[model samples]
Target: MSDFTQQPQNQHGSHQPYPGPYGGAPAPQPQPVRNGLGTAALVLGVIGALAGVIPLLFWVAGVLGVLALILGLSGRGRAKRGEAANKGVATAGAVLGLVAMILSVVGAVIVFKAASDVVEEVDKALDSASTAPKDPSTAESGAPAAEETPDGKPLAAGDASVYDDDLQVSVSAPKPVEAGEYAIGHTEGNKVYEVSIVVENGGKKAFASDSLAVSARAGAEGATAEEIFDGDTYGKGFTGTVLPGKKATVKYAFDAPADAKTLTVEVTPGFDYNPTQWELTL
Candidate 1:
């Protein structure tokens, strides 16, 4: 018999090799599920939704929302095809992106409407100011000449001062009056005079009589005259409203130096009106 070596053999009688300690060629590792797109979509959707509530950020939110929606849809398709994991995450990202886009549109609309309204109101106010009449006395130059009466002279008693609005104010000639022994605002050496002031509202709107003001100066020295209060016939000033085409009259007493020959009275209809003066012989 020829010399022979024993070897492991297969059932078919062919030589066979022994298996290695390490497992058969390591089973190909399953490729890591590609979920990057899904994750990115979710992140962008969350950011877009957060910004959507702010009206000023509507543009940013709209852009992010569109990107999220596109990426999420692609990711979901990949998940369906077994290319990516996190199918639920991809779907939620798409829904959130849609919500963010809707909010952005609403916010943008509100912002636009508010801006338009503000612009319109500003335009109306400008128009009204431009069309309103201006008073020469209140002009930029502020010249004393602009404040002079139309006739360039102080009005005489019983003369009416007509305003730009057609309202008229007049004062009656001063008449001597006796002060009650106990009356208020009387100076021992002063003479008392009573005068009537009349305000006529010729404009379409009612005139506010309460806003009327009257003051007087006595003699060439220009001393301020004191107003007298005698319960019976003096001290009541202008009051109530004067309707269109109506008149309001009030009587007032002033105390002046006994030798005063003239009383210069000034009348103002309202805060907006220019003061007008009258010269009254006392």
Candidate 2:
């Protein structure tokens, strides 16, 4: 035998290296755990994109797309250096995220445009309805002749003063005061007067009566007098909806100064109807 003993060899036919200080070959370094953020970003991006189709959820898609892009870049770097195992998946996630974001924006714009168009159409329909005229037969169904008199007559009491040729408007003389019953009662230094005005929808279309109003004054150039007080529920002076071929009668009352000798009444048709005036000597 030779002076030294033979040592065992590895498969490469070289002698085995000596063991580490305290153990067999040093434990292999553990690999860094694969970052799952890339996968998470991919999932979120898909979900966000779907929700983003709804106009209100577009913001969510943008956030997910950005996150996916960041994770994909990081994962690609790791993969190039042999640190991560899933480079292809990360890239796919990033690309999908970008596509979803673009789709979200486009979808939101389309939905908004459609809604706006619908609203515009509805507005047009309403405008036409409001401006259209009613049929002639309906509007002039019970037309009265125009009456012009210095002293007005009672309308409901069948003594009307003026009736328009087309019967679109009728004005009656001041009704006699029935102080204890229908008239404004117990004025110390004032006289109460009531009048009736009738408006017929002479046009084919229905119209709102928002523009009708009545007023009384001491004389042609006198100060406007106060309207007689009526409870909210009892007062319907010159305010209501009148349909095509329909008729509306408005009752108006005012208190004049006791010594006033002349009173003037003004009936203004709302919505561009010509105003009518009458002078009555008290």
- Writing each residue's lDDT as its tens digit, candidate 1 over 31-137 gives 66899888888998999999999988998889989988998999999999988989988888887788789889988998999999999999866643443223333
Quality of model 2 by C-alpha lDDT: 0.62
Clashing pairs in 1: none
- Residues 24-130, candidate 2, lDDT per residue (tens digit)? 56878967857585576567667766766776676777777777777777777777777778888777777867866886787678778888999998986675445
| Backbone collisions counted per model | 0, 15
In model 1, which regions exceed 4 Å deviation?
1-151
Error of 1 at 11 (Å): 11
- List per-candidate RMSD values in Å: 9.2, 10.5
> Candidate 2 regions off by >4 Å?
1-142, 146-169, 178-186, 230-234, 238-240, 259-261, 268-282
